[model samples]
Target: MKKDGQDMRQEGALKAADLEDAVRRADPDRALCARFLPASVRPDVEVLLAFHTELTRALAPARSAAIAGPMAGLIRLQWWRDVLEGARTPDHELAPPLLLALERGVLCRETLLRILAAREAELDPQPEVSAWRKMMLDGAGGLQRAVGEALGVRDAGVLARLEACGAAYGAGAMLRHWPRLQQSGRYLFPGDEAGLRGEGNAFLSACDTASLPSSARLAALPAILAERDLKRGSTQAGLPRGLGDRLAVMHAGWKATRVFQRSGAAAS
Candidate 1:
């Protein structure tokens, strides 16, 4: 079962490439992640983000689980086990950095176990309806706390903020994807779709309306606002008026609009 030396190196290079690509994709979140980090500790915070980025993708490919059935989505579970067990048949790209992270002996094993447990909710079909939310909350917190430790932040203030951001991001992601989970009655929270949809509708309603842009377009507009806004206005300057309306005109005129958000939001 042993592989050739050249093949091992090639596999390692591919994993590293994958990891780098994932990192680049998550770069958009820097504004949010950096907000809570102290000037001195932000570098470490950035490093920990690499961990979260990897975890997200680790779950993403499991989206194929929709047709594959919830239980069959256990591909990601095996991948995590494969990671922690150091069985690098695929040669984990993260292994080198994580090994270096462990050189200081700061990250806890319990932290990873919590991540595994939380992620298990997504895989397990038999979980009690009410147990899903608690599993996700606790599991997400565990991973964040683990990241905090690895980053060497001992101050109580910074720790709490990091954990808060972690919980918020984790909960938000699950909520964003709740509809699909609801379809299978496999929600991360313990509720049926009718109940879940009402709650989701209410929660989403609470988000700020001002986040929309280009112009003060309708809530359902497809403006690609962030990048478009940047092009129209400098980082030092605020957004222009009527940009949303203009973008709407552009899309509507050409009939070129596509889905604004991802599948979960599209389902909602």
Candidate 2:
């Protein structure tokens, strides 16, 4: 029995290490942010991020698929939905770690479905801007909500703020990836050229940074990174290279820590 238990423990550890490596490779920015999280909750956050990466990548082939047909992408998304709904285990390697995360309450079925739905919407050739915006907000907001839950944040108000932060983060991400979308003959913003020019600023302006709970701020740190990337004129071409990007991430972390400290002092 002891030997069996040891083998199981080793297997679990190896699985976790693989998940971490996957996250690091697929979503380096979020993986970097995950480094600042408390050890106990870090894996939970990493799993959520890894799940997001999986959903995002699953749609990559469809982005450049001929407009007349998107069946391939649709099928991929359906498979993810099936897995989340417990139709069957995922055939992909990423699914096992994600399943473990789900069992641990690091993720929930409703939020996972929301994320999948957002990916499905992207398959639309001419998705309504409003619908797309709503999907992005839902997907991003759900992620923050899950992170907040993992961090033991139960306040409805704080969760709502986190959702807003997530939306802002999503908007910034869309901007960052604008070049890639354009190159693929796909666009997400709602408007003419003039409107496109203003969209990034509009999203940044709408972020309600002040209302976020300090304890949950780490969940929204990506918003700060997004803002910095926008200010630096980063696009799908790439983010600011080297030291500049590193400093931006560090600054965002420092800001979150400072806010948390202030909130703690006020509570006392």
Candidate 3:
């Protein structure tokens, strides 16, 4: 029994290291921002982000494949749905860590399903801007809420701000990845570029930080950065590389910390 226990510990550690590596490779920006989190909270947040990265990456082959095509993507997503619903056991490397987090309540089944649904929608032949917008909002809101839960934030106002921030981030992502999305043959914004930009700007304008809880500020930093990128007309393939991106992330983190501190002081 002792030998078995020791083996389980070894396996668990390996799984965690793999998940961390996946997150670092798939979403380095989030990985960088995660450095600001307390050690206890970082693992859960990383797992959530890793799960998200896995889903996003799954869409790539389908986007690029002309033979097996989007059907292949749909099947991959369905497998995730099956794993989440417990209809099938997880065998994929990424699935085990996410499954563990789900079991531990670090992640929610409903939110996972919603995110999967958004991903599945990308396979649609005539994807609408409205549908994309709704998916973005739902996906971002669910992620922010999950992060807030991991951070022990329970304030309704703070949670609401996190959700708004998420939506804005989603909008900014759409703009930033416009070229790639177009190349992928996906119509995330359809034909209404102006309308899409208008909605993204509106979401950014509505993200109020003054009331956000201190513990939840790190979870809100992506949204803050997204808003800044949108304002600066940044529409690149990925988060820009080099000194500028590093400085932007650092600046956003600093601003969020200040807001959180002020909120704490007022409550005291």
Candidate 4:
């Protein structure tokens, strides 16, 4: 049976909604921060984040299976690269929205490639501390840049700040998830636990979220919880599970909203 144009649009909408829910379940911190964005771009933010989550999940088989797992994961990552480069097309749900994002300039090919490269490196044997640190920073920071671009932020300074914010958050996340990663047979920084913490702290110290332009606040908002999680030490990998964690994100998002409003008024 042939599907009409309206039917196709409806199907796309449903898939997008399902993808958003999946992202909420898979990456809750970023999902919560996404709520603070303007309605006009919230979907874009959510979808881009889902892309990040998908990239992470692509490594699951590699982490689990014994022999063929890593190779399988590498092939999956390569498939995404082919799709992004227009070398292939599959009937995947996320591909449509992702390609649309790339076409609309909301995402850049280079940033996405960097993310893929980082993931590719993850499949390799454990890296040196410096190499691991670079991979984490580039992967996380690249996602931040993509998010900021979706928010219409083009300022070099703001993008740099976003990168720093994401790097801090990434380091803290690695610490929090160290146990889980160890269980999965993944050693990011090897035995240098203290060094990893120092890297996160240094990145956190360099981040000035208060000075960020209002437009980029949501993109950098995860750093709020990153600071708290880092202070709490690396006992668990999951997001902080309490009303307090929710309130902290809410408070920072609220303040950023106020700034956004003031900036909007000034521009008008």
For model 2, residues 1-268, the per-residue Cα lDDT tens digits are 1122111123223366666777776666677777776678887777678678767765666766666366787887898788888897666655776787788776677777877787777777354667756665667767776777777777877766666566666666656666665676544666543443355455445556656667887776766766665564434355433676667777777888777668768989
lDDT (Cα, tens digit) per residue for candidate 3, span 159-184: 66776777787777677666676666
TM-scores, all candidates, are 0.49, 0.79, 0.80, 0.89
Per-residue lDDT of 196 in model 2: 39
- Winner of 2 and 3 under lDDT: 3
Give the runs in model 2 whose Cα sits over 4 Å from its true position: 1-14, 125-127, 192-206, 234-236, 239-242, 255-268
- What is the Cα-based lDDT of residue 176 in candidate 1? 44
List ranges where model 3 is wrong by over 4 Å: 1-18, 125-127, 155-157, 234-239, 254-268
Candidate 4 per-residue lDDT over residues 1-268, each given as its tens digit: 0122111123334365565667777777788888888887787777778767767777878888887768988898998899888999845666787888789887888878888888888888565777876676678877787778888889987887787788888888777877776677664766556877888888776668877778888788889977987887666565455688889999999988888878889989
Which scores higher on lDDT, 1 or 2?
Answer: 2
Q: Per-model C-alpha lDDT, please?
A: 0.43, 0.66, 0.69, 0.76
**How accurate locally is residue 13 in candidate 1, as Cα lDDT from 0 to 100?**
39
Residue 123 deviation, candidate 1, in Å?
0.4
| Alpha carbon deviation, residue 121, candidate 3 (Å) | 1.5
Per-residue lDDT of 132 in model 4: 74
Name the lDDT value of residue 245 in candidate 4: 81
Please rank every candidate by lDDT, starting with the best.
4, 3, 2, 1
lDDT of 1 at 151: 42
* Candidate 2 global lDDT: 0.66
lDDT of each residue in 1-268, candidate 1, tens digit only: 0122111123333343343334445633332333333344443334444554455445544555556664444565666557665664535544455544545555554556566666666655345744654554346545555655654545554444434334444444444445454453443556543444343333233322234221112211112232233233223232223545354435542321122223225557
